[model samples]
Target: MGQNSSQGARMTSSVRVIVVGAGCRGEIYSQFASIHPERVQVVGVADPRKFARTKLQQKHKILDENIFEDWHNIVEREKFADAVLICTPDRLHKEPAVAFAKKGYHILLEKPMATTAEDCTAIVEACTQSGVILSVGHVLRYDPVTHKITELIDAGVVGDVMHIQHLEPVGFYHFAHSFVRGSWRNEAESSFALLAKSCHDIDLIHHWAGPRRCVKVSSFGSVSHFGKENKPTGAGNRCLDCSIEGDCPYSASKIYLNRVKQGHTGWPVSVICPSSLPDIESVTEALRTGPYGRCVYECDNDVCSNQGELSCDGHEVHVFDFLTQRSTKHKAHNDAPRNFGMSGHGGADYHLMAAFISAVANNDPSHIRSGPEETLLSHLLVFEAERSRLESRVVYCGDAGRR
Candidate 1:
């Protein structure tokens, strides 16, 4: 579990990759192949949706024989690639991860490893036992802003990292779209709001804490705004049919259509429909019948609209706010080099993919920053924080939680 240096090793050959899920995250991670064809190539892809699979195939020039309608089809075949990117949904991570790891394919699993602690541990064990590299999707670790913050801390410019306060602004429209009426709306279907959305925040906090374990954790949050109890007096079930849609801040029409009108039809809009380029008609149709079109308060979302978690090891303290994002003016960040393209997650996506490709190509685990054990530890902390929030008590991590 060595931390990869930003200077990745030279690849002797392209690292062949099989994408297990062709959804938004899958599409984003696989774009690395298009950027660095000599270093990485997508050899296979699997998705239940034909649109997703076909979209990835067209982008990466994947063969029709290699394209699969289901991940199980990929797993059933003999191992045909050097590595696998398990970008499946939150609940669909473990099976493909274990299967690919057992097949001797190094893995790049998306964040929160799995929905539960047991499943996370199982995926880790499978990879560890198989002696294959497992890198989790903690993309923020590779972001330039994060690197600057850590560099400042290490240089003692912050003078003893005893306390850190962090805030992540899950914007109103974003929260309404992703958490209130989207795939991760229900805890049973996806995960608790914190783990589903803020695992990266917890992982960042854990990374900053450095070697100190999160021994004690207490959290507070609940479904505050986007619940049936908060529905407007005369609001319809769906935004398209609602009379108050024009006045509501979380209106689907406003959020989706406004972005289209602004010529910003990438994310949150592309996600609403199966079309590669979602237009006004497709968007309107999706709103008229799809989950994204539902009224925020009338949806079945149960995740917390706002949440906070506090972690301490009896000596140092860390605080995380999952609602507000305040700007911090820092000279170091302003002066940091911008070599990586700021496309996805401030270009951390490119760095993470580069590191993983280099790691697999050279058979060197050090090329990855978020190794399996490190990712599992951070994920455990997140689960504990969620537990504390639910039970309304501080939970002690003791020996296991420590590094």
Candidate 2:
């Protein structure tokens, strides 16, 4: 945190950036430029939604000529910025990443790199060929806790690093919001639950494993909680019309409206309704019509809410768990006000951006922890783990790249 900020300010000129996909991730990364005006500046933005892109356009004072409704438009035109932040949806990553890398723009692509191993490889290859810094958005690597863990292992405090067990509690309401009714509900639409929600865990495991490559991988998971068979007998398709909605733990109204009552109109609330200061009526209307209101048990979501994967290098074992269950109560949002600023992902988002800016400003790739090759390796592990889950067999990581 300390060095990343000072390193960012060392540049002669702020690194001009183009933000593609002005959605939640897009907005989070774009805010970095606003905080450090001398380090980075948002010069262009591309998004299909007027409501989304307009926010960045106004906040960053981006010129009309630089605003684009499609990323293809940005690719066609001459590259205007030194770097591009590819925060597009999961399926849309490879094309934009490859194109932008070919265009010679240093890229900060969001996690999971791409849906397929081949696509991920292509992005890495493109960045390698173009000789531009390619930083995948593995924000967890920059977390203060993660750095401490790395230091302990490095300093021999944790002697002879062997097996590591990790758990990613995706949380009940959060799972319903993101993996059930939200953008990442289905694997085909986005990715499997492991890749979509818990890739961070996988990457972190890889980081701790260090040079000991995962030789054998096997995984298991299913949509046990949110399937149609689990829905209440008298439940309505939407929470608004449901008779037993209030008693349900995954109720949309209970989730979003309660947040509004707590004066939290950002995130899970803003995702459903576009209004800045959405009242109860607007949020209710959004739940009534939008996909967010759909009953968690009735949505088209097929990804597993509980997933487990085991990877080992023969001697040491690593266990991964992605558990999302019905909770009795949701945690209070103590940091809601600062949420609009840099406090996302335990403040790792800000650190990741700061490191990226430092790398771009100084033309030094070493500042990036999750660079192309390492990211591709971790993504391959995720893909292989999924294959092992579906196939019910062990998958050798060495065979992952060939496949």
Candidate 3:
């Protein structure tokens, strides 16, 4: 990796950064910051979970005073830093982002921007008002593979970008862990599958096709497999206590119990909560009463595990999350479908961050290559698709003015 010489070759001269949400994405940001100490220094971290904050502090050697539970408090108490990384859940991005932006801090916002378009618009307004460098974390735009594809398409290797197709086969294990068994299990909490998991796809479609207003869209989906209706008769109250754990494909005991045995420590255990009576009683109690502990088959989760359809611009995308399946992949097509292969953040978040960082350092929006205006079109497409899915008809994405 090339070093950022402009920031000086000393860790002390690097941009002082703080990360909100010490979860998976936050951890990744911290690790990246740690590795490039000369370019970025993680000065603070915030998460409600004590374990998450403690682990991040220990991992990155952040001072105890800088480990906070609430990011708002951090922004309130501390002077403006060079940059802030908002790695919180989709729903929680707006507040901290708006807060830090007003403080004249450059922002690295996580994707989906917010749970709703209105919230997203508000965030954009806040950033614009503050004149802070704001970059959304739609990282797929930065992937070498994806960048190559974009180049080929621009070069007319893929003529006219006619009716692009994409697939997010959210590998079964990933689907189970995130959509079925993790923080994103409920639509109320996460908005919907499209926004929560597939916003990157929406963003990508906008990026490739130019600003053709999404004319029509439709979506169809069903929970299909994971729910109380599908649970076996006489199934135990919890996966760990279940008698037929071996027979069931979504056996928490088999997946998480074995995972814990293999030394896979971190949020997954707290997220999945395999044991009815967990080794850590506090975590078990938290799961029992909180959204995380509910049996995947017994939660209030209504988002479809399998969703697919076409957008008005003739672009087609399919998202099949076999919460019960095992592998994941993303495929895109110009003339025919070409496998782009699997990625760490669905190939979106990482790519988005790299581009945003480069843009900030370069002081150029053209280098951003993607922006809210373009990403918002994809958001509209998804909205239209959801509408069509419910109404059972094609919906067109009309020229809704930039939000």
Candidate 4:
């Protein structure tokens, strides 16, 4: 309620922005502008989904003319905005971001920045050339607890972080929802599992690794557990028709109905059902045909459910999962980053957005802790890790922090 109340509040913003993609990430990050009217203004919004785009429209009181169906239209018609919040999918980020950067708009892009190494470089070059502040979303570094950890390490409180045992146990159901059945299901479609999911931990590991650059990297994981062989003998292709779905932990009914039990249908549910559909019927039909409703063990998903033995800086972390569900257990002692007069006054993710808005407001890059260059190191680590996995040999990631 505290964060929601902060979001609902109205204030004036020096940094007015057009939301380029009205998906989950776009709305969550850019809504700060909607919430804190003083720090940021949601001037325009663009998304392929009309309902999603219109939702942002109603919230911000934006004109019908300002709501666009795609980034292409916004760039063609709208001459300028103070900043562009590019929250499109992994594949779509580079173009809208580079376009707006050239248009003299500061950018707050979502994570992985761009899927490809080349695309990432293009984004960095665009911002550098355009002289617009570019802050890729690396929110873990902005979290207060993470901030405290950063402080502790800097102050020698944690006996010198010689080795880190990080794990992103992205929760079984969540992994199925986002990575298995959802947008990031395969390497060819969006990105490898590592970049799409665990870039946060990779980035965090790099942040903690600090000056200790990786000399060698190797990774090995596959779709061993969640494959056709693992599918139960009596299970149908979809959850709706599947007889054994009740026993399955990753069943769609178990996932979405529980949300219904909680008196809300956000995220995983919203993803399965269209934004406009009633939860029960929508989810039912989705199970009948949609990708999300497919049996977790039966989907065409190829990303690794688990990978480990991340050897970095002479330290061997035997297991590190995507998005860090288990690493959270370590947070009781090890805290995250702290805030110092953040611009929009939100949490780590929100605060990072705030810092970007504040940086735009103050015209100071120092306001943001991680910019394009810092983000690149983490992305490079992911690339090298993937390379190591594919080539089956140690890839030398010389000077990971030296970009």
Pairwise TM-score winner, candidates 1 and 4: 1
RMSD of 4: 7.2
Comparing 2 and 3 on TM-score, the stronger one: 2
Span of 10 residues, lowest total lDDT, candidate 2: 328-337
Q: Give a tens-digit lDDT track for model 3, residues 58-164.
A: 87788888878898788778574677889898888888988998888888877778887777878888888988777777766655456555666676544576797
Q: Per-model C-alpha lDDT, please? A: 0.82, 0.83, 0.65, 0.75
lDDT of 2 at 86: 95
- What does candidate 4's lDDT look like per residue over 1-403, in tens digits? 0132112223344678899888777767766754557777888999888888988899888888888886888777657568888888899888988998888888888887988888898999999999999998887777655665666677654556789788766777888898889889888888988888778888888888878777777788777788888788999888878998878899887887667667666666776665674467676777777898788888878888886323222111122334453432223122212332122212566667767877787677776777888888778888889888888787877765334
Per-model TM values vs. the true structure: 0.89, 0.89, 0.79, 0.85
- Between prediction 2 and prediction 4, which has the larger lDDT? 2
Evaluated at residue 198, the lDDT of candidate 4 is 79
Report the number of backbone clashes for model 2.
Answer: 0
> Could you tell me which 10 consecutive residues in candidate 3 have the lowest summed lDDT?
334-343
